[model samples]
Target chain A: MSDANDGAATVHLTLDEVRALAKAGLAKTGLSPDHVDAVAETMVAGERDGCASHGIYRLLVAASSVKTGVVVPDAEPVLDEPSPALVRVDGKGGFAQLPFRLGAPLLVEKAQKYGIAALALNNVVHFAALWPEVEKLASEGVVTLAVTPSHAWVAPAGGTEPVFGTNPIAFGWPRPSGEPFVFDFATSAVARGEIELHRRAGKPVPDDWGYDPQGNPTTVAEDVLKGAMRTFGGHKGSALAAMVELLGGPLIGDMTSLQSIEADGGRGGSPIGGEFIIAVDPAGFVGAMLGEHMKHAEEMFDTITGQGARLPSQRRYEARRKSLTDGVDIPAALMRDIEKLLEEA
Target chain B: MSDANDGAATVHLTLDEVRALAKAGLAKTGLSPDHVDAVAETMVAGERDGCASHGIYRLLVAASSVKTGVVVPDAEPVLDEPSPALVRVDGKGGFAQLPFRLGAPLLVEKAQKYGIAALALNNVVHFAALWPEVEKLASEGVVTLAVTPSHAWVAPAGGTEPVFGTNPIAFGWPRPSGEPFVFDFATSAVARGEIELHRRAGKPVPDDWGYDPQGNPTTVAEDVLKGAMRTFGGHKGSALAAMVELLGGPLIGDMTSLQSIEADGGRGGSPIGGEFIIAVDPAGFVGAMLGEHMKHAEEMFDTITGQGARLPSQRRYEARRKSLTDGVDIPAALMRDIEKLLEEA
Candidate 1:
């Protein structure tokens, strides 16, 4: 490993090396070999794509979840097609990736046949970044929208108490001839993990990011972690968060954000919630006009980028390209923590 | 009319009186009887629900569009089912309500059979609020998501140029045994019409609402009208606006936001854009669990509202209920404008 210095020490490791380390660390948690590989692949992509919070930083949590029996290491998801265009997957208390991996092919097939399809996952633990799932579908030429709810950490616009999750939503649009455009974001002003990272670094957040424990706006990250995160865009972002809570929770027969938190008793592991994924095929509706459609989209992109505007995923794509050649840089402390886990295993 | 004095002259009129005025005012625009009725119903609902920007304030523009040969007053939309779960409508240059009125029933029917359905409208001039379309579907126990793109009025987060539309999106969810929950909002920090209203009233807007012509944030509404509106949640809202642009424009073989502006030669009328609506039946997947699903959602609403957090559309519903009894309050100046149009007819 090579060390890259900014203010803190960071270690650069090849993608394959990181994947091997993740797999080795997770395998000892009693996960099946296939489960271990799936989790490792997801975390590797997270690191490669520059989402450090969701990358190797989460491996220890996964291991602890397995050891605490919160996540069943060898559980299998059951897939059912309730309708021609609707799929339901019961994750059976397993990692979210397992269900998505089991059901994505079927979702693509249905979308190809029916023009659109919806997949709902229940009783799943979503621990990875959401973009990988939608981006994978987009790679197969499918436009996808995915959403999931976590523990309640965000407050409504005018209220002080937490009633919603960070509630991330992801969208994927496939280009006619190249990589898909993907964007995933938490509806809150800032992701909870980012605040935690700020707190760990002993830094203050922006005033708009969250409220303190007394329900007053505060810049202290530690204060915000003890209080609640504010939704982005005031009332509008709050509405979107509520939409995710409804779609991912009640609509899917799973736990709402508050329910998830209460049930888990804040064990600091992945929450047992639901995920909703919808896939649509452009060719299904546009048919021969698909090229024209894509051309128009490209024109919009060109006009915007020509004026120096960046698309949501443009920076991530650039980071990924550089990582492919220069390797992924992980925080030196986190690298040490993973190594300790590996040694123990 | 009873005048309510508050800085400006406002008049209270019964819902029936407002609908009658809207129907009479729209009838002179060369629209067919059915088209006029549909437009009137949508406008009346907008006023009754307290969205004054989308209510009587827009009648003059709608009539002008029809008179200038931009909107085809009598044209009929043609509905086509490209797939079992997809319904396509060609608006044939008509008012937007025509297409929804013609295709919504089909969308509902198909959603009943297929568990999910999508309606794509092309060449439509959308001049009314979007909630009506989705609210109608929710009334029939169908969950609906609707989106439409207007002319370029919003700038990308980090860019100065206007490349995206205000691009409103609406979502509706039906309760098991009551009125549905619905919300509609523009991706921009504030709707363009509201800014124009503020300009008319000679009031300054919040600095975050928009930018001046020099790409600097400004509170002057007139400068914002000359410049561009900012997205609500910065990059997140900008990404959503882009999503609506793609889904409603290129994906449906229609014009992009800037393309619509150029096509109209900046006539300041409603643009011929596309609309996308998706409907899903909860019972199709959850079956008997639908009630349980709704119970969880109600609990969330209760807990949030109990803590004084208002859900989206809660105020709208309350306003509508009061309007049904105490009548709708409209600005006297707007009422006079409508009466003048009616008198000319």
Candidate 2:
């Protein structure tokens, strides 16, 4: 893989090198080798899929959080698997991906036996993306819905000042074609990471994408960080974000207002990031009849998109296909930045 | 209670009277008395909350559907309860509200026992607003999520022709203030119901809310119906709606594309609808520690919105409160339309 730096410099680093570098950085923060490996894998997957904002870009931030003891590495999830159909975990301030990865197989296994299973994780951190997890489950023929709660960063309609994070929700369903329809997105006008990207690139953002400190639409990335982000669809996006906060922040015992208050008061960090996962078995509903319905649904989808309906995540996959088939193109400057992080370590 | 005629200009009718009229209309279409009453109750609730488009206004269309034999009232929901934690219901062509109402209770019951439950309802119709069901659960101290596949009337980012519906998703959680935080909204720039409202009122819509047949943004509601509805926040809203469609539509066995195709072939009526409901018990996490967290969550909510975070659905509740305290205020012209419907019946 070609490397790039934020300052427009180019360097060369294979994908493995980058992953190893990220893993090494986490180890420096007191994370165990296994846990560090898992985190690195999750972040690398994002980068591979062209989601730079969610991938290596977060390495420094996550490390800083760990260094500040904002997150715990050795924290074992508080498991509450009382039944075959139910599983719950308190992440206990560990890597967000750890609890999910640990719970995915268990939940999927339960679904196979009981037809459905749910695992709720409380007190994790920013899960990179839902598509990856959903994709994993979908590959195994399980339908999944993953929801994560967030903080106050996006404003509601007709008002300004952030009150919720761009809580993202994702879903995956399998088709007879052995392909999965995966959909994932943040419930905000735009994700904060996107803005951070623009800031790093020193580029102007779309006017309606964010707001200034006075709550006016702005093109400057810096202003949005100081103020609030706009919701995707005025009231609609705002409503969804609130839902995430309730689920990820409050309902699941993740970040509470008290936690934020404590964080703000310079007390030890405590934004218990929470996640909810649902897995389903087709046998519960249509059973063998599912194939028939899926075929019909496909025909219907084909008819509607006669010209072409862009299936969710198809674009990203296509991009990935192109990248792999041709070459994993990287911004020269970004590669340099990766090298810098490694050398600094 | 007062009765009115369609041609009798502005008039007032008690909520019960309106519901009765709707029930009578449904009865004329051969729906079972129980089913008609259930559907009528949903419409009345929408009207009481000032959601006029989803209220009595929809009765005409629904009755037409039943009269045309598009909706089968006697169809029973195919319940597939694989475990206490999950349920999958096939509406089998019944009224949309039937499965929604039934599913909510079942999911809530399961959640009450196991701390979490999920229900997926397939082959239904427009479920109206999701708040009532969520509020019902929330009032009982449970958190709920309700999502439904939508009609294909909205376009994804940078695309034209309605390939998606103004899919609405709702989330509800209880607050100690005797108020539940209930959020219901469409994933489009504006709700299809809102566009219908503007068209019925002979008013123009806002630019960017929808597009004309030529794929150009227009303020004309008629144009939106002919063209497409815009997704909120560009690609982000489109992505979210796509997720809803996959989970609530195809995965659940309702496909909008097929609905349009069947409609064209005169083999079906309005699109079949699908919905997913999830309920989670807070005690599943912190156990007895949940009470303290709830308090903290509410406080944090208050602190954020106390400064400026507008809680979702707050305005709707405020409007409903005002209407109840001051008496349901019916606009002069709308009152006439209701009277006309009664007379026509």
Candidate 3:
């Protein structure tokens, strides 16, 4: 397909079809069949949930990481219990998804036994969105919190230098029925991907989104891409980002964002850092009040939504519902790229 | 003292002098001697750290809450272990400080034993800042996180109704040699105290700080105080505030922000809600590497601050150091009010 024409066209595919295409593209990157399935399934979820930034758009980037030997396609995560309630997983310089998957059962088991459990995954490349992992635990009736660091793309509140990542944190709360209340957000004023999109479209971003190369606040998307992103809520967001770096990095015996960048000689692609996940069983503290507690949460949600305020995951849920019937709309150009990768395999 | 002239004067008091004065004022509120000392010490710390809003300035509010029977001065906190790794405390409708104090030793013990521990405090009126509680745990080489719900003062993003609390969350990370790193901030764009200060000064706040009664964004401090404060970071902060409401409220079988306000019959004072605390031992995960991990964190701090970035709590630490030598500076007007409270007691 001609690039110009392909860019203007969109391809609709069912969830299964997208998963199959993603799996094939991932397998072509020399990942083991099992590993490919795991990663591809997560990518499919990203597409299904309208997280286009984390979906098939990232397939080529994942392949490049594998080609560059940054990620070991066949490495198995090593799990150990540092304490009865702490599960440590060494990702063996591989994808974070597999280790998280390998550690989930133990995390759930320990949480049920001890009322809470923590899983610390180190030496992994965390390239996917965090909600999927926490959502998995929440689906099993466990409340979960997950945090991971990334390359430093954000400046401290008053500093010009990029010293922190657009550090993302995810929280999941189980409900009595239906989907859990889940929210995942980066601490930056705007996600880097959104800025990139704006730059591509020659658009100006909001004034608070980022700074220019000279460290002056700017609305120019191109300038923001060349400079640094601001933290979401100024100093407050910066502090939270710093907290995430500590909890997900050094606290887990992994590299802080600056350390990771320094070790990579300033070369950046996917984040090679640590993932910290904590799971808590509601019954442990509230006892029989768990049901009532969840009901209260549901009522608050209704009250807020009734006031015309949208919840964090509300848009994603709406997109998901639409996608379920209409299928995912993939750019034709990206589809062609994926097909090309499959043919090479 | 005349109101105008006293407001212009600054009274400097030594740490001991401040503690004595605060104790005298708290004792006048009909609290037990032990409770008076406990509450007074926290107030002294706030003054010592230069938190003007939370320090002796709030003494009258605290006293009024006691006098009105909103807080039971002699109520003893009851602590029980819900699980091996969970401690639950019922504050008996008293001060949050006592429950936190009563639960601290057990929380530390359980964290040391199981790698992590969670303390849920309910029915407590949280009158002070959260840092003191977490800082106490961090001093013992435990990383801690604490969150509490308050009366509704912040609005959900995209809505003007006051539905969430300022909902401050505090985090403390233990350092190997020096004092621990700690940060406490409300999820709102600006703290309510700050807005009140702006209103008193007849100054306009930032446009993003709050909304008018008509549900439109406003820079008028008076309008914001009469309406609702906006969450920091837009939707991201709202989500976090909601998370706090869940974890600190229903998850602990305590009143949510709205419920607390309603139960108060719309009479606002200090927050009567729940407090959730989690403590984790680094030795349980990285063992001897804890020192190295802390060193790495220090290096990041150095790099950031060396480039002009100020870490959260940096100013507080500076203030505390200055206070040690020069004493705390209190507004003369506030001192007069505190003296009146003491005399009335």
Candidate 4:
């Protein structure tokens, strides 16, 4: 049941089984059935694509947040028609998944109808990667960009204290066939979990990953967890992070990461905030030349791969292909944690 | 006139004088009078913002490109309304400056009318920073994002050869008062000009800035200029650069960086490619609450600066404020080269 070397164990589960497990755990949190269904799909996608950290592992975070009363378990999300080309979804302080799901169709429709569209989801507890949202839009034949600000756990490039989130930006581009090109990444040099893992393993973190309580760069993971993290690429990443805050926060008429964390009230729950999504139809720009333009995109891909450079999401897509045939493996302890939630419910 | 140590000579001129010089040199390129006026504004803006490279120094490059017939000095830009929300401008192989100028008003108008709009500039010779375009849109009280791919001079992360451009991403947000917030930066670790400057000074480049011909990381700026530069933030920046290429190139139905470079036929002129720009009107998202949302934005900025973290465009804005009255300094040697062009005309 365990791998002694890493003190870990895994359990294999088919894609359907993973979804069922996620749904059960989400249901245990008293989320509405329809909302649970929407959120579970993203969890399954994460697992299928080898993003174990964002996969069913998030079920624990969700359940815990609901129990802490930081996230609304069953509040219905409300869609707002802000403009012809702007869609706003008030999550009603619930999880962002359902609101995003409800808004996406309209976003895609608006993009096709108006050439471009923007979606803003506010008053939501965010606990998922942005890729799922962008990917969904891309599948509907559009280019998508999504961004969100997490809890302010990272510092600006020149600042000693935390002033920005481990903000993430996700982008997706539709392909002529097969899986879309997608990338979702945090601006933080490293994720908080990575530092926690290092701490658990009694190892030092890499420089630039984080700083000590004194605000000086340190490799001590524990200190960083208690202090602050740094953004990737220093100031450049900081700039991007600030941009995320502006777009997903104030622009969306929602809370900044600092405000989001304060709303959490030291509960260490999922950050309560907003998300910004933009969708653009290729047809709007290229019209009948869509196919021709897509071919040009493929040429770009070929050159990147031909030079032995892998495009973003290529490995994830590859993992997905294999996992679709061969079921995914979930860490046994994590599976046990999910089962615990179901049992409690 | 020469600085003893760096061998750089300075020439101080009023902003009016700078514009006159720029217009004179641009006229010598056989550019249309109106196009010259449009392009000259951007050049003057660069100088006033203390960006010497993008300032009047670019005049020499423009004149040389026109001389080689690689750039269409007098080509008229054609605008097409592909859709109610999209504006396409065929620069007809001329400077992007003129195309952008002709397209800006339409872009702003559409953003206001439709809430969101796109402006695509194709078949253009680009020789300027993207800030001016975004800033202008911001001046019109809208949020803007602009991206473009330069010639392929950068390598993808973990790749050995060049497969990407020093692609830049620029963003602008309108402020309640004062100038709008703006940032434009290349995804490359550093600009190609920085490496060339280092090479000229017989200095070694920093690690991760570039690689040798074999693709191994190197500190020799010369090797990097001949081989390939690396993207900033390693893989994250690489992903961003690829996104820029997709959104600005194929998405706009124009040439990719590699294609653009090849189209140049080794003339080493400005890259003939396309630019993609998006503008969003705040009123669409926040309605009459636009002022309230912007106040939230100011709060975010306050925290960043309150913690002593400088915002991305603060320095440039500060430079502009001072230079507006104090004027800007130009290198004496560069001025000589530009004046020589006027003499030849």
Candidate 5:
């Protein structure tokens, strides 16, 4: 079976079939069927939402982690409810998504009681793209802010050590259109995933995206292996990455990016990768305020974009709409691999 | 007195003297003494905080707005209690800073109760840097996010039109150190204020900080008149600016940038400016968790920067500490001018 980067290869599969295929791939690793479904569901949704790097493409990495016992299934999460508005969850070496799925609902519940809820997860795997969870809350009229400290793969602004991950932040607000508005991006010049993909393809990276050892810009992904990933916009992006590390890493007890690289195989343990999620119930704060604000915001967004501007989640919503109408767009290479795995299962 | 750009040079009065001078200047314009003092306090604090662009230096702009009836001093803010966590304040043609001050305390109060509070403001003259207000809340163990939209003076990623303002987003989070981590920055490459300052000083703008009319990079501020301000990181910056416009503009019933630019005098009587602020009480969610998380975060920050990485607010905090002990570093030229202004007053 070929991969998407293997050139002109794309296989079409229905959303259900894709989900099933992903589940089967996960199941092949001797995982419980339900958890497998959840992982596959998230991956497929990620692919459907145009986040290919975080989508089914990541299944191999997850499988590898499972085989290495880096991802422990059936591990119970340690949740400490410190306040009505905050919960701290220790992943206890389980699948990262499970704790997040469990914690998000609990956070929303707490937010409903108060006006906001903050949940921190330690000892969890990377939760992939942070927007999906945020979007789910936004749809329920909750404004959410999510941050995560990633595996060490990015360098600071002026350094040459991949001492920081592509630390990302996701912010979302509920809207009247039910589509909501969400913004999520890494603080890196380019996400580390792109670098990995480039390396896998034996391709050179864009000079602007990263730097080689000695802090010189290079187009070689393999060079990034020895050097560091540059921050976006120099100092500003570096500052943001630092803040994310503070908020998402040690603040939540996750290993620092620098420490992650020092770990064996670069997979974080102890405090699972730190993730912080906050949900605010607009109705709780201002009642119909969010609704009114949404109405006015729609007008403003409309006026700005005029003919062509779209909101953050807008493209994804459009993609989803199109998918529901004409089925999801599944890459051919992914489908073939999944089919093979399904048959093997 | 001649303006800074009028070749009159900057007058760096003692912080106390600067505030008094601004108050006196406002008082001469038929503003109530209290209103004069409030506005002066905010403006002066801006300069003290090293935000010279929005600081006491902008007194000229503030005076012009008031004289032109753009900033009404005696006007009262129309307050609406939409929910326990949200408050809407119609600036009612008042000084933007005035309403912000009034709303800040209210937000803190509500945040303490609801765990999260949002205050939206519309129909006011420009307010200075938002960090000060958010920082005040952070001192009380609250996290704050503030967004403001101003006149359109920036372009989208690929376009050449200044379709958005150098809109800024300010955020604050409290750490165990009792010093809050605050970030305030414009979505544009370099804020128009910074560019104007450079232009006034006949200094060239930094490459990658701005572009010329032909979409070419230039350091000449004069070129900005013909060209447009480019977004910071191409598409990412543009997306962020658009997000700020939506969440900070129409979301607060303020006019969108496009609409304001289309209106009379580009902004006069436009009532298009908008502000959005959210404050969340950590006690509401995490209880004792904040201490632990923040301590860990500080440790991480220290370790990462042990190699000399600077966090977002580290410089400001250091500067502030120095200023308090050894006195703030006032530019020699600026100091002389301020002395002259004092004698004249």
Candidate 6:
């Protein structure tokens, strides 16, 4: 939040500095070399894209899981192609990033050959945003929808207790130029970190964000966190959350959010589950007309932006551009937390 | 709507009668024999499932399209397989239902063989709820996601003018027994018909529904119809709507909502475009564990219903059960409208 080098709450750091600090902190937890690199890449990406909660702040959570021995840092992911268009990656209870990295190529190849394909990452300790996954695939000229369930921290619409996760759905579309259009969003009214931030600041959340233990709407962030969080757009958002649970959970042979928590045994570590990512190749569907259709999409974007409306991914792309040149800034408090993780061992 | 067919303004009819009337009315429009049967089935299903808006009321829209030559009543849908797992159905500018019916078997076969498959229906006049499509596939024991863009009537979250369609997204997951878990919803704050109903009744909608011509949020339904409608849940809904546009439009080599409107040339008929449906076979992913995973899904459903949180598709299934026994009701005014359509030449 600050560019000044003075003693401020916000501290400025170059991209390289962010990477080195992230690597150092993760390494302190005995993360495998290649796995650490895969995980650290997502960390740097989060900082570059200004998703601070998903940035180096997650290193503490990773270290906590490491302390619990929940994540298999050196586990080698096993890939299985049960059917022509389906690629399943068994993460062997390790971090998700490496498994996705190892399986994405097969997903791409399948989509190229079959017009559409899906990658299922099972038994992974997931702890990061899904945009990095979709973003990388979109850069490879594929349209994708990626989803995963988290802890059972959210409630279904019209329900009194938690029955679903803050299940996030990320979508990516390859643009003819510039950054490919992308969005990664939790189906909940807001991310869990949002309520946490509100509670940390002693602030009241919006009425729609969550509910009290009785299922009645509440503004107190801490009470709601202890109770249940609502989904965005009411029942429609809840339906999407259910889809994420079904697809990323039982559909792909993995744990549901409830099962994930049950498996954690109250340790409160990162959720160990599965992810479902679907990729589509434009050429396979359109043959030679891909260019003309792509131009039409460009016009659609222009119409949206020309009317003073912002695309969902525009801000992150802007932050990414600026961060590439101007580096990034983090709270001094967060830096202290990272230092604590490094000091633990 | 009333169950009393006496002197009141409502009429009651059995499912059989509903089907007969629907078939007669569609046939009166010179619709092809097979097409009439296929379209009539959806009409009956809509009425049986208590989706009154999508029920026999659509006969009027179908008749209007027939009069305008926008829908080719005799059009025979053509199917082409461009890749191993992609089935493209060209509706030849006919209704979407028939094309989907003609192509569904191929989609199922592909999903069975490849683990995942996609069906893209192009150049069709879609006028029904997507539940029936997903429900059909879900009954066949495959998971499905279907999306289609309609006429441009909704605005992006930050924009004032219409740039996107209602853009419904539907999902279906196979349950262990009984009906599958299914949901189909528009990304808009509410369906376009809701606003139209409010306008006809001279009622004020909620503030969240739409905006005035100047982009100010307005409860006046008429003004919003003339201006722009907002997506649900602010930016998150807008992003999902955009995903629908991209996937149902350019990615499938079909017209965007804007292009569909431009091509409509103010006829105000149904927008002709594409529908994208993805089918995933559970057995391909889970193999022998399918039954075990399915039992887990049942437990998940129990958790949902145990909390008094109704599943998205529960209402329709309930209506279906009741309708099969008692029948459905409609306003006398709607009956007269259908009579007028049938009486036209």
TM-score for chain A of every candidate model?
Answer: 0.94, 0.84, 0.94, 0.96, 0.90, 0.95
| CAPRI category for model 3 | medium
Sort the predicted structures by DockQ, highest score first. Answer: 6, 3, 4, 1, 2, 5
Per-residue lDDT of candidate 6, residues A26-60 (tens digit): 88888988888999999999889887877877788
Answer with 3 or 6, whichever has the higher DockQ: 6
Ranking by lDDT: 6, 4, 3, 1, 2, 5
TM-score for each prediction? Answer: 0.95, 0.86, 0.95, 0.96, 0.84, 0.96
- The CAPRI quality class of candidate 6 comes to high
lDDT of 3 by residue, A1-345 (tens): 111222667898998888888887888898887678889988888888888777876788788889887789988889999988999999898898888888999999988888888999999988888998988999988889999888877888888777788899999998765578899999888778788878877888998887788988898998887788888887889999998988898888888888877766645668897999888887888898888887878888887889898988777788888888888888888888778777873
Question: What ranges in model 6 sit over 4 Å off?
Answer: A1-7, B1-7
Provide the DockQ value for model 2. 0.41
Q: State how far residue A221 of model 3 sits from its true place (Å).
A: 4.8
Candidate 2 RMSD to the real structure: 4.2
TM-score (chain B) for candidate 3 is 0.94
- Please report, as a residue range, the 10-residue window in candidate 2 chain A with the lowest summed lDDT: A1-10
Residue B292 deviation, candidate 4, in Å? 1.8
Model 3 residue runs over 4 Å out of place are: A1-6, A201-208, A212-223, B1-6, B201-207, B219-222
Please give the RMSD to the true structure for each candidate, in Å: 2.6, 4.2, 2.8, 2.3, 4.4, 2.3
Say which prediction, candidate 1 or candidate 6, comes out ahead on lDDT: 6
Taking the tens digit of each residue's C-alpha lDDT, what string does model 1 give over B181-298? 8888999888787787788779999998877889899999999998989888889999899989988887777888988888889678787889988888777678889998888888
Q: What is the DockQ of each candidate?
A: 0.73, 0.41, 0.78, 0.76, 0.32, 0.86
Chain B TM-score of every predicted model: 0.93, 0.85, 0.94, 0.96, 0.85, 0.96
Docking class of 1: medium
lDDT of 6 by residue, B1-345 (tens): 221122357788999999999999999998999899999999999999988878888888899899998899999999999999999999999999899999999999999999999999999998898999999999998999999998888999889888899999999988866599999999998888888878877899998788888888899999999888899988999999989998899888999999998889888888899999999998888999999998777888888899888999999999999999998887798899888877877
Best by DockQ: 6
Off by over 4 Å in 4: A1-8, B1-8
Task: Name model 1 segments beyond 4 Å from true.
Answer: A1-7, A212-214, B1-12
